[model samples]
Target chain A: MTDVAVIGFAQAPNVRRTDGTTNGVEMLVPVFQQVLGQTGLAKEQVGFWCSGSSDYLAGRAFSFVSAVDAIGAFPPVMESHVEMDGAWALYEAWVKILTGEASTALAYGFGKSSAGLLRRVLALQLDPYVVAPLWPDSVSIAALQARLGIEAGRWTEEQMAQVAVRSRSAAAGNPAAQLSGTVDVAELLSRPYIADPLRAHDCAPITDGAAAVVLAAGDVAREHCARPAWITGFEHRIDSGSLGARDLLAAPSAAAAGRAAGAGTVDTAELHSPFTHQEILLRGELGLGEQVTVNPSGGPLSGNPMFAAGLARIGSAAAEIMAGRAGRALGHATSGPALQQNLVCVMEAR
Target chain B: MTAPLSAPLEISFDYTRSLGPVLAKFMTALADRRILGSRGSDGRVHVPPAEFDPVSFAPPAELIEVGPEGTVLTWSWTDHPVDGQPLDRPFAWALIRLDGADTGMLHAVDGGSAGQMRTGMRVRPRWAAQTSGQITDIECFEPATQPARQSAAEPAAAAAGQAVAAGQAVAGQVADGAADGAEPVTMIITPVRLGYQHTASTEESRYLRALQDGKIIGQRCPACQKVYVPPRGACPTDGVPTTTDVELPDHGIVTTFCVVNVPFQGQRVATPYVAASILLDGADIAFQHLILGCAPDEVRMGMRVRAVWRPPEDWGTTSENIDHFEPTGEPDAPYESYAHHL
Candidate 1:
């Protein structure tokens, strides 16, 4: 199999809202230019293009198609899209390289989450027949999981608050982050609950952003990047969709993806955990010990741009290795309620 | 450097779903104020019954009557409820384990306050005054201490108890209306509505603003040099924004057209009108617009046409400023002039 590596990555600033359209053309254009410029690759040189976004987020059908305009996709280009997070699109790009169908690929994900009442719109992701009819907002569903862990003695509110404090402090270094700076855990605890057991600091802010990553196989990667983050393992797994049937405290899917992707020995890790408790929960499930540096970019709790945040996790983790700060790193992404679906990518400097 | 144009956008639709045998039976039972669970191959029952056994991936073997009362396994309080939730006031969303079921079901509990909610609190269904074949038939769960609402199915409670003891499938029995030759629910309709602030791209915004002044503006792509009317976020071929603005005359030739005899909802024009692709002079792309002031058959390819604007006083930032196009009373251009546009 051909070895694929991440050669370049770029992202838009995470903001509460963007004046641009939901199609993401405005947000995506600059990131595409930046990523391509970093790799010194021209638009026509990219062999395959894939993206992740949701029409439901845009409140318009076929929204992703209009995003191609940002690519200056003139003439025609090989392209595909997934109604999932951009991390999944990266997974597809990796497969395209491995199959020898393309020597280089560009994967992107974007969302204008502020276009709608994000939590209410997210209810549509639930079981359409039964649960969605009741319209349980996303925050309430996540709080249900947080409380389960709390009552089970698996994690506490203070511990969850500590995760928030650490994430915001880490994000102070990330210029693209929407929320950053020092915060007191005690102060966070004193805040009123948006959903009982969940303070505002516990949840990820609704953000509008876009991200792009360039991947190349073998010689093409070496030609562009002096120190490429070579992908050692890539895998994803999903659990039961029936929320009531599964054990919410245990994310079997994350564990499975972690084990398959050889995540145990990474020196650095980036996790897409939208809520504070989830970061703690994922830390246990992925079996990352205290030595593993986590969320150097502050993770999703700082600024989660829906579909784009997951891809940005992979980008951030790969940067640690590409920058020679880490010998190996792991990037994890999640979808569905209570971490029902998960993807893990382990990269190494070679 | 001004922001793009934006407006409120609401999308709504009713999705009618057909429930298979298992859910059909389940929903039918809800109409009678009874809760049902599906018995999995593992012998564990799933509330709001699973369409298929989780372990075996086979259709459920049977549906069993669970409980009108249960214990909250976990919960979170919603201080201010959003639209479409089961309750309007402050309520706790809980995972409840009904009596005789191994798994939990998600629903709301009207516990009155966060202080009243706990991990193991007992609760019972607060049935809707008018039962429908839907999950909302049980308005929400409340403290079991509250008196259960009396229903017409009171006489069958003893029989239901006997069936539970024997672990028998009671969907056919408890859904009494079905036993008396009434139809089981075969379908359900769920209405979904979402609102968003729809925004137009900067380039498109410029074109729309120009239209309000009765001007047709096009932009020349820096890379391809193709002139695009109404502009574009990026020139599709060059992957770059069209920078140089070009003003075009309203008069253009119809590259192609279709006579719209069929009528659609919300259509402003009557049937048999011409909808043509107008390729304005000095522009590379064609835009769709109505061609009128002539018979349907008289509307031909390469026909010369000019914009028919609505009164200047009525103009806004909208394409509707152009009421329609009419014949320019000039000779039609040769087919060669628009062959490439088609």
Candidate 2:
């Protein structure tokens, strides 16, 4: 099998809102240039291109197609798209490389989540017959999960607040991050609840951003990067869509994906947890010890750009390995409600 | 310098979904002011009935009555409610476990305030004024006034048999109604609406701004030199911005066209009118516009047309500045002139 590795990664500055169109051409253009420049690879040299985005977020159909403009896709290029996060697009690119169909691939994800009422729009993802008809907004749904974990003794509100504090402080180093600063855990708790059991700081801000990662196989990877982050394992798993049926405290899908992707040994981890409690939940589910540095890039609690944030987790993790900051790293992405679906990618420096 | 042009964009549609057998039984029961649960392979009853047995992968064997009242397993308070929620006032969204069911069901609770909501509080259905075969038939849950009765096992068993028989009868009515045309409710229509502030690209904003001044402006792509009107954020072919501005003539040739003989909702133009792809001289792409002032049958590819402006007082930041296009009495351009555009 061809060994795939991440050679380049770049992301747009995470912001509360962007003046750019929903097609993401404005946010994507600079990031695409940055990633290509980092790898010293020409646009034509990319063998495959894939992206992840949503029409629901944009309030229009076929929204992802316009993003192809950033690729200068003239002369026709091999491309595909997923209505999921860019992390899943990277998963597809990995398979494309393994299939020997493409030696170099670029995966990207973007979202102008600010274009619409984000939490309300997410209700469409629930079961149409039963839950969605009630129009349960996303924050209330996460709050239900948070309370479950709190009452079950799996985690506490103070611990959840601590996660937020750490994330914001860590984000101070991430120039592209939307939120950053030192804050007291007591101060975060003193804040009023937007959704009871959840405060404004506990929730990820509505953000507009895009991210791209370049993947290459074997010698193609080495030629472009001085030290490529070799993908040792990549896997994704999903739990039942029925929110009430599964145990919210235990993310079996994240656990299963972690086990399959060999996430146990990573020295650093980046998790896509939109809500603060979710970061705590994922840490337990993935079995990362106290020693394993988590969310060094501040994670999604600081700046979650919807579809792109999940992909950015993978890019951030691989970057740790590529920059020689860590020997092994794990990047995790999640979708659906309350971490119902999860993807884990483990990368290591050779 | 200025922020790109933006406007409110609202999209809405009714999504109709057909419920299969399991949900058909579930919803029909709701119409009668009763809650139903499906028995799984593990002898557990799933509320809002699981269509397929989670473990056995088999369709529900029977749906039993679970709750008109239940216990809240976990609850969260919503300080403010958004549109389309069960209540405009603040409420508690809870996962409730009914008396006879092993699993919980998600719904809203009219708990008044966060202080009143607790993890194990008892609640009951607040039926809608009108009962329809829909989930909203039981509007929202309210705090139960009385403690749930601890009826003996024997009476509960008898009640389960009666509920199962009632469910089968509803299913039977649906089966028979298929022949008689008095169809039971087997489908649900959910009207979904989302609003967005749709922002145009910087290049597009520039073009719209030019239209306000009675000018047709395009940008030339630096890589491919293709002139795009209402300029693109990036050239579709070159993946680069079209930096150089190019002013296009109002007169152009029709690259392609279609005669609208059939009318649609909200259509402004009359039937038998021509909608043409106008390839302005010096522009690489054709934009769709109404081709008027000529017989529909006379509108042809390669025909020369000129823009007809609305009153100058009516001009704004809109393409509507050009009311429509009319045939120019000039000779038709050669086929090769626009064959590449098509």
Candidate 3:
């Protein structure tokens, strides 16, 4: 097996709504060109193309099919899709390179979350036959986990407020972030709860966006960029959909995936936490010490773009390793209701 | 131009789910207004029993009477309700561990505001005004003020692990054709309806706009001299966009066709018609359209046809503006001329 590294990455500015359709062709066309141009590669030279999206998110089946026009895939390119986050799509592409399938691959994810009520669509992810009929809004589920942790003394409202504060402060530096600002916990605490024990800031803003990442095998990586963020390890797992059968306050899937991915003692980590309390739960589960810088790209709390947010996490973490700023970094992604599934990827600068 | 318009569209279907045997027994019990739990191969009682144990991957056989009362394991408050939620008003969603059962179930709780609801609070099932095999059979779980009359089917009093001894006592009261705790028998049909504006591609859009002016336009692919009636992003064979515009005659010969004996979803026309793929006089690719003014069996390959337009008022930016194709009254083109198109 050969090593694959991130050679180029690009994303559109996160926004409340994009005039483009939910299929994501309009948004993907320019980014596809930008990332290819950055690496000095043409569309014809790319070896593999894969995407991540969901039918429930777009309110239709085979939603990703029409987007192929952006690539002008008349000759039929080698492609596959996962009804998961784009970070997982990148993981699949990375594995292909490792198995010696192709030297270069492109992975992308796009969602128009603003098209439908996002909270409503998310209900479909729950146990469809047993639980989904009740239609539990996602915020309420997170709040239930938040209150349990608060009662058990695992964390506090003040501590959760601090995570939100630092996320926005770091986000102010990212031009693509839709929401950012320095906020004081005292002022935020005064606000009313959307779900008890959780404030609006504790939740991510509904966003619509697209993102792409380019992966190249061994020599291809060195030729495109001076410093490459070579992948060291990756793993993912899923827990039963029965929310009652498992512990809600902690994520076993994240812990298992992190350990399998060799995520230990990294200089920085990018975690995907749509809710503030999840960040606290995930940090302890992944065994990240206080020294590791987390969410320097503002994370999902500022602008959670559904399918694209997870891939953005990988892109954000790779940026640190590519800039010669970090030696080892970890990128984590989650899906299903209340983090029922998880994935972890570790990369090191070389 | 007209201002764009929109409306709420509900794409729904009953989704006929075939519950082989395990799920059938469960649904039948729900119809009898009873809560039945199935004991899995692992000795765990699962509510709304699963078809197979996820871990053991085997069918569940044992049965237990659970619910009517349970304790909340974890509770979440829904502040902003989404479409199809059990309650439009604010409510608490909880994981309730039913009495006499080993596992828990998820449902809505209506015990007042956020402050009153606690994780360990006791609640009872609130049956719906009507009974069905669906999950909606239980309206919501609410605070149980006092002990209610317990159903005799509940063997909670007979002592635990009495499976062999207790089977005879409960056998008499079992509903006719009920599996007790196996699976439910019901068919739910979920209808899927999706609507799209179905915009034409940039090249096709230009061709349609020109059609409104009664000018037939074709674009010539640079790699191949073949003309494309509706220009494409890339040639299907050579993989390059058409670069030069060319004029073409609409008079084309029928390449091939299939008879419409069966009606299907989203059919725009009546049955007993012919849908033919026509290769225009100079174009390389074929397009699908309806053939009329002839018997279904008479519409043969290489039959010459011409566009039949609908009244002008009904015309818009759509190929449907050309109602159907009618016989040109000219001699049928020779089979040798159009055989390759087939």
Deviation of model 2 at B250, angstroms: 1.1
Q: What stretches of model 1 exceed 4 Å from their correct place?
A: B148-181
Q: Candidate 3 residues A144-247, lDDT tens each?
A: 77887898899898999999999999999888898899899999898988877788888988898888999999998899878888888889988878876678
Model 2, B95-206: lDDT tens digits are 9998898888999888879998889999998776544566777677888964433322332112212211111122334552132233466776666777899998899999
Q: Model 3, residue A106: what's the lDDT? A: 91
Best by DockQ: 1
Tens-digit lDDT string for candidate 1 (A1-350): 79999989899999999998898988988999999999999988899999999999999999999899888775789899999999999999999989889999999999999999999998899998778878899999999999999989999999999999999999999989999999998899999999989999999999999999899999999999989999999999999998999999999999999999999989999999999999989999999999999999999989999899999999999888888898999989899888989999999999
lDDT, model 1, position B339: 90
List TM-score per model, in order: 0.95, 0.94, 0.84
Rank by lDDT (best first): 2, 1, 3
Error of 1 at A311 (Å): 0.4
- Model 1 docking tier (incorrect/acceptable/medium/high): medium
lDDT of 2 at B93: 94
Scored by Cα lDDT, where does model 3 land?
A: 0.76
In order, the first chain's TM-score in every candidate is 0.99, 0.99, 0.98
Residue-level lDDT tens digits of model 1 in B1-342: 978889999888778777777887778788777889999999999998999899999988889999988999999999988777777678999999999998889999988899988888899988765555677667788989767644324222221111112111222333432523445676777777778999988888989999999999899999888899989887877667778999999989999999999989899988989999999999999999999899989998888999999999999989999999999989999998889888
What is the lDDT for A21 in model 2?
A: 95
